[model samples]
Target: MEPSEHARLDAYWRKIASEFAPDPTARPSSLLVTHLLPERPAFVRAVGAVSELRAVLPKPKSVVAAARREVEQSYRVDELTRERFSDPDDAVAYLESRAAGERIILLDVGGYFAPTLNELCTRFSGTVLGVVEDTENGHKRYASGEKLPCPVISVARSPLKDPEDFLVGQSVVFSAEALVRGRGDILHGRSAYVLGFGKLGSSIARLLHAKGVHVTVYDKDPVRRAQAMAQGFGVARDRDQALSAAGLVLCATGSLSLRGEDFPTLRNSAYVATVTSSEDELELSGLPAGYSRSAVGEHITRYETTGHYFYLLNGGEAVNFLHGASVGPFIFLVQAEIIAAARTFTRAELSPGMHEVPAADRSTIAAHWLNYWNR
Candidate 1:
């Protein structure tokens, strides 16, 4: 280990020395194997005593496959439900069967699943899993139970990047980037109006903020509205205010409450889009000339003459979840880490019930994601 790494580990070890001490008859602490292991494990001796302990990391391919399969399995309850499972009723039946009388650890990474999932959780007497999605809606659900039937599991932080590395040479980092590149629209100067401050909306705000775009947010919930302001976002108390000024309006509220009349004030030059809701369902027919809608892809195409707007990039799904491919791998990885550690600490099986996935697990997951980025 380099001197800095060694020093950092030394301080970490000192702080948690009691947790790593050997127990005469118990399994050795995984903390030792995980936290104390060298950044690059080698056959060299001076590394550390804990480095000698066997450590097992899950295969990234397997992890990705499992997640994809789960997404496929959860077609009904997930927002991607409409695209993947043509029949909503069938999907609901399957979800109900799986959730009946069980504890669920839902790692809601986006706000799409909550509405239906919340109903399912209440109906089946099973808990909804984690609410660690990156939107204000999820955060509000976690903070207040007014709209939720059961308690929230937890909320997630942003994905981690490797401290020492950046980017994969040729691979797409985010689905949005692919769409943006494909559409040839520069997002740098665009003003994005996000209509919601929930988990998913908050995440979108952060991304746009980081990209140097002016982001104005709107949410009726006072708490969420306050939270957005505290984060240095311009909070739009009224939806019209946000819509009239933005170059692009991204509907992130996960609510169908918005109506055609609500957006009549939008300027013809402004593009209308959403991370939630399908283009066909957006009721954009009455939109003025120079507006259009399209699916989420890497690039966006504008059809101003026809009043058509393409929502390209990430399948028009929650921007953050689709960004997970490169920019947010830690989103899932952190949830996995929390699941793993929760399992380890409680010796509990992964089941249904609203369970708190730890934030530390998320940090570790972020670290691993960053490591992958470097490699």
Candidate 2:
């Protein structure tokens, strides 16, 4: 870590040591059903240590073959499950069958299985206290104008956007560089359109502009659009026109912002990718796509549309994540946020609506993360 990063972390960890030292044995005994990527085994073990982890339902989209192996080798969680399954539905069913009289708690990522979430709340009823989802896209399902059956806690909108900016911004730029590594200068003089002007989008735009690429940013929220304009980025006054003229279209919105209807508005050569959706089902499944594996070998799948050819890099997964760079070293802090959010979700006296992670918990985690980051 840099000297500044070390100093920042030292302050946080010092507070953590003074305030909240961990105790593995004092965890509450509760049934845990999780659906997430397998990249973070430390996350699995941490949550398991705090609960009776019954099953680890690894979502296939994010949990690549190597991730499955990592789960096996690194997840030494003895307090919960020992089996792994490909199907999230089976995991849900198993949890349902065992839900006759149990206190169930869900630890989810990307909220890939909304049907599963609905099922758990339906089958378990009052027994399931709440669920914690770490992705904005997943939280959107519950936060939408639909009736929810159980309590939900979302860690996606955590106030700690600075660290997230560090993780996601660097990851996207790194991946983009990787994509153009052997291709001989594809990024320099190209126009790129980024959807959403939030932390990730803004950072990506700044980085691409620094590379002399023409960058335009679009956002649904007026405040966000204004923010983009203030940052001196091209604010897309006309979405269709901006998208169609771009050399690249990066979806950082984390919502279902891009769809089949929207694809007609993009250039045939535009390299498209999404950032926040953790599953094919949540974000990519709805796109009107007809793609096949590219013989060109970069995992660049080719799609035929608009009487021309467009491409979906990494099979419509997050571009940054496609090259094995999703949540990097800063995940320790993110997991800390999730841990605090999950614990707060259970005990906080909030209503049945969406809520941020408690301020106190956020402060505590930030402090702890500072300590960890310094080291």
Candidate 3:
């Protein structure tokens, strides 16, 4: 980056740090793994302000290369550490090596460092402070683990995150629409199947409906389906039927909601996308024999089998990530919540288990967000 651009970015982060300052006493050394988008500098600075930032691990597969380079240059992250971020095992080992004497906290998104969580906690014991997870997928991963040795604080479901989640849903629809329009097709007035009627899914459904797309909502939970129905959305009583009918299918469940087995039932030429960062939302490996796939557009792929074809947006990864995964200024609320969560984890005596960001912390962050933005 040029001097002017660097100065501007530094000034932006400094303002964020001032506005969202956490407790000064809770500055534990931290290892962070999150999407390295341009907007993330503010988050990095916010977290760094309240912690001793040991390493910043950008998910190699998901990070925007230019943005990653900018952050690396701006932060002066060394080449050796940058090399380690490319491999998960190496990243974990690096963090393990850093946990010898000082208290080490982990701030992770999507549980990118989850595979080694157990070993890290087991080996480091008291040295490993805890983990602060940033997404629902990561929260589920840590929650499902067998009795972790340290607290796993989740800001994913915090009320402060609701706005971010809603904006994520909007971004999913926006990116999908942009891709479809690029292919000389229109999404308005078409049918769409939205899997997982969670906050994100529901927002996408409503946004699509507002855009004149006929949307059908499906969820594994009966209550969510009922809620969708109550909200006047067409609930998918038959998953395969819905899949076979819609021209667009969006998976937001953060799991393998769409598998290869279900691909055969999808409408030919249907546009499939996801809202989660990983490919865990769609399982394309189970595709039957004779299936063929090829890139059809930037971050779009065409898959053909059984005399039919469907397009996968962003390689079945989160569609929004292709566009920097930004939710604008509201994301700062959640970032501040993360900083607060990290501070709480280090200072408090929380037990070894899954925990939510305390309501008090959230309120404080929300107040700061309002004050900062309104100012």
For this target, which candidate reaches the highest TM-score against the unseen true structure? 3
Assess candidate 1 and give its lDDT.
Answer: 0.44
Query: In candidate 3, residue 341 scores what lDDT?
Result: 74
Runs with alpha carbons beyond 4 Å of true place in candidate 1 = 1-152, 155-185, 197-212, 222-233, 254-258, 273-315, 319-324, 337-355, 358-375
lDDT of 3 by residue, 5-62 (tens): 5565456556556644555665588877777777676567666776778777776556
* lDDT digits (tens) for residues 1-375 of candidate 2: 367754554454344333432344433323433334443554565665555565566644445565456656744222222222234556456666544556656666655445555656565533666767777666776677376666777777777745666578767867766675534547766688888777777878888888888889999899999988888888999988888898787877767667666665667667776665424322445556553335343756666644776666666666676665555446656566656655654454556656666778777776666656555
- Ranked by lDDT, top first: 3, 2, 1
lDDT of 2 at 347: 56
Q: Whose lDDT is greatest here?
A: 3
Which lDDT value does model 3 have at 361? 69
Q: Give me the runs in candidate 3 sitting further than 4 Å from their true place.
A: 1-26, 74-92
> Candidate 1 on 1-375: residue-level lDDT in tens?
378755643443332222222233322211111111122122111112221222222212112443334333323222233322234455346455545544433333334344465555555454433333433334443444445544444433333312111231112223444455555666667787877676556776777787788989888789999999999999986777667777766666655424655555665545555554343225545445554444433434343344423343343333323333342232234323333332332233434333454556555545543554344
Assess each prediction's global lDDT (C-alpha) against the native.
0.44, 0.62, 0.78
- How does model 3 score by TM-score? 0.88
Q: In model 3, what is the error at residue 222, expressed in angstroms? A: 1.6
How many backbone clashes are present in model 3?
Answer: 0
Candidate 1's TM-score reads 0.48
